[model samples]
Target: MTIRTARDAVTAAALYLKWLGFRDIMQSPERPASGIDLRAPGLVAQVDPTTCPATLRDVECLWLNGLSASAVSVFFSLAGYADDARAGADALGVPLFVMDLTGTPQPVNRPADELVSTGAGA
Candidate 1:
């Protein structure tokens, strides 16, 4: 649940992507830098299981990597985030996903007003 390993994060991220309508998803949670945790078509998602606070640099690197591949950027962190990381995500209009003890991912920072018609539609 706390997602202690990259493998665990990979499973969680993959499930999250599936719920987003991605039938085929790739995961590489342990890999660093441009290494992505989940990907499908035009979406690129990454997961951070680090115990320390996720930072702005982490978001920036993920954002840059996703852009290089012309994919939408998504971030998931089990360890929460630094203020700059959260702020940067909001400014960049990215979804900042956080996992609970059950390893379920939710977009904690993506505003409800920005919500499109996600069939889950919550």
Candidate 2:
């Protein structure tokens, strides 16, 4: 049961959200340099597999918008990228959710407090 990349995770997330009554709001604009991958009504989500510095800023914007809109903010990533996602979410005062798309859809929602660790100290 090898886990795949974050894009795969996000695609799985989109399918799950659809199953849970969410429609496909928007897709990436196919820009090679764009940071945002998808944009849904009331929610902004991203899939990250690397510690790319750009992801932090991108997630921050998503977090702020998601918070303002009272949306269920999410970041789907491979296990390795969880820390980076959490850090970005914390700085933006938003929640970072984790979804194990590799198996049975085990999703974990980490609030700001829980993700604020001394090492990462948000």
Candidate 3:
């Protein structure tokens, strides 16, 4: 569950978003100044999966998200960046979502039969 790189963090965020019904989630090109990760075009989510420490300014992005279009921030818990990320999100007035990589599994069941079942009356 230790995310080694930003890419790993982003991938995790993408999966979580997909689970939340955000399809075709795409990430932005890695840039020095973008300060963002995944971007779902129509969705008001500006993902910033950072392994480094966050600052007060970083938190502002969360608030910005709300002001702009109800964007949400997703952070992957790295070495010690959780506090900074949280603070940044709080300051920015955005809801921060953290994945529990070490927590117990809470399985979500999906009906396998539905994948292939075309029922007129089965």
Indicate the residue-level lDDT of 116 in model 1: 26
Clashes, model 1: 0
Q: What is the TM-score of each candidate against the true structure?
A: 0.82, 0.53, 0.54
Q: Give the candidates in order of lDDT, highest first.
A: 1, 2, 3
> By TM-score, who's the top model here?
1
Model 3 CA lDDT for position 114: 24
Between candidates 1 and 2, the TM-score winner: 1
How far off is residue 7 in model 3, in Å? 0.9
Candidate 2: misplaced stretches above 4 Å? 1-7, 29-34, 51-58, 65-72, 80-93, 101-105, 110-122
Per-residue CA lDDT of model 1 for 1-122, tens digit only, reads 45666788878777766766666677653585575777777777778877787899888887887788887777888888899999998887667877776788776785312432351233
Clashes of each: 0, 0, 2
Question: Tens-digit lDDT track for model 3 on 9-49?
Answer: 66776665565565567776673354556656434333344
**How far off is residue 67 in model 1, in Å?**
1.3
Pick the winner on TM-score between candidates 2 and 3.
Answer: 3
Candidate 1, pairs of clashing residues: none
Question: Which 10 consecutive residues of model 3 have the lowest summed lDDT?
Answer: 103-112
Ranking by TM-score: 1, 3, 2
The number of the candidate with the highest lDDT is 1
